[model samples]
Target: MTVIPSLNVPLLGVAVTPLNRAELLAHIRDAVQEGRQMLVAGHNLHSVYLWYSLPEFRDFYDRAGAVVVDGMPLLALLRIGQRARLRTEHRIGSTDWLDGLADLEGIQRVTLLGGTPAASTAVLRHLRSLGGDVAWQGIPGDPWRAEDVDEVAEEIRAHDPQVLLIGMGMPLQERIADQLAARLDVPVIATVGGALDQLGGTQSLAPRRLGTMGLEWAWRLATDPRRLAGRYLLEPMKLAALLMWRA
Candidate 1:
């Protein structure tokens, strides 16, 4: 698999990988050529909540290849919670990986799952603009549960991409990636929440200034108040309780 060793930084009882962004990307590129399938995961607050509070997510991540800090707070939390000396130069999330995949060479094929047909098609068009040689496929459907995974896996196998991008959002995407690890012939599977939507022009990201200040969550909460209130507020409070209980 990936020869690059992952720093084992466990937060709220869930294992997280803190790796240099450049190195990990290179390793993923190399692993694809070597035919060693790698399952990469990136964690946001919601992902952390699920990993710590749900046995199902905890188990799946334990079986993953590498997990990066997807949210800004997650990076700080990982360093503060465990292996204090750990220093990951970049907060390498799935969105960053998606950008890299489109920009980087040698990766021949990719499959995108999630986003509406319009959004997914837009994402494919963007990827094509970045690189003409990268073939793309969009698995246009949401498999909300484990039982639905079999048919989804079938669709993925039919295209058989070197990199599989799952964008169905948090827990669902996490579960889907786990189910496909053994079922599909893809070399890499990644979970990117709404990234395809952002790329497809369906959604917009916060300003870089806001992101650098770690106010990205606030921006999201403001823009999509209805959808994010529970995630940005309730889940974090629940997570605090779990952390205190653990302590």
Candidate 2:
């Protein structure tokens, strides 16, 4: 199995792997070819909140094979840690690379879980257009609950995909990813929050320039203020207190 280089900082109390887009894709390809298991995940500020507040969520990151920096603010914090060695390029949002999975040379089958039925349909349509040689399947994970794992695992076992992308959103997706990873032989199970929704055009992605400037949160707030305002505004303060308590 590939032992991905990981670092855990006291500031965040979470583990992260510093892999840029190309390196991340290469790692996924290698894991599949080598028949190795990897639970690919990422952390943003909201996930950081969940990490401190939820034990099961924290456990998933502690054991994840790869946790890349998904939030630019988190990347900035990691860069200061000297030991993390995170660079500007290491900040990878799923929107930046989810489409690239279609181009991976060794990957032949991919499964997508989560999003509404319409969103999953759109993702399948998009990916199929990119990789004619690959097979894509989507299992709508709407209304997902902890109780649904067994049925979902059975569905996954039938598909036998080389990669599985779960996007039911934080904590829940991470929880399901952890359980499914343990029960299935799939090589890579990536917990990719709402990347599928954005990719499927059901959700808007911030412009690339804005994301590069570390103002993607601002764009998200502009788009869905009611839902994201508290997350963007108040959570950071809560996170600060959590970090201080931990420190």
Candidate 1 lDDT score relative to the true structure: 0.75
Candidate 2 local lDDT, residue 92: 93
- Backbone clash pairs for candidate 1 read none
Evaluated with TM-score, which candidate comes out highest? Answer: 2
Model 1 misplaced regions, further than 4 Å:
1-4, 8-11, 78-89, 142-148
Off-target runs (Cα >4 Å) in candidate 2 are 83-86
TM-score for all models, in order of appearance? 0.88, 0.94
Query: Which window of ten consecutive residues has the lowest lDDT sum in model 1?
Result: 1-10
* lDDT per residue as tens, model 2, 66-91: 88889887777777774565667789
Q: Per-residue lDDT tens digits of candidate 1, residues 77-181? A: 666766366444556655556767765567877899888777878888887887557778886644355576788788878877899988988778877777788
lDDT values, one for every candidate: 0.75, 0.85
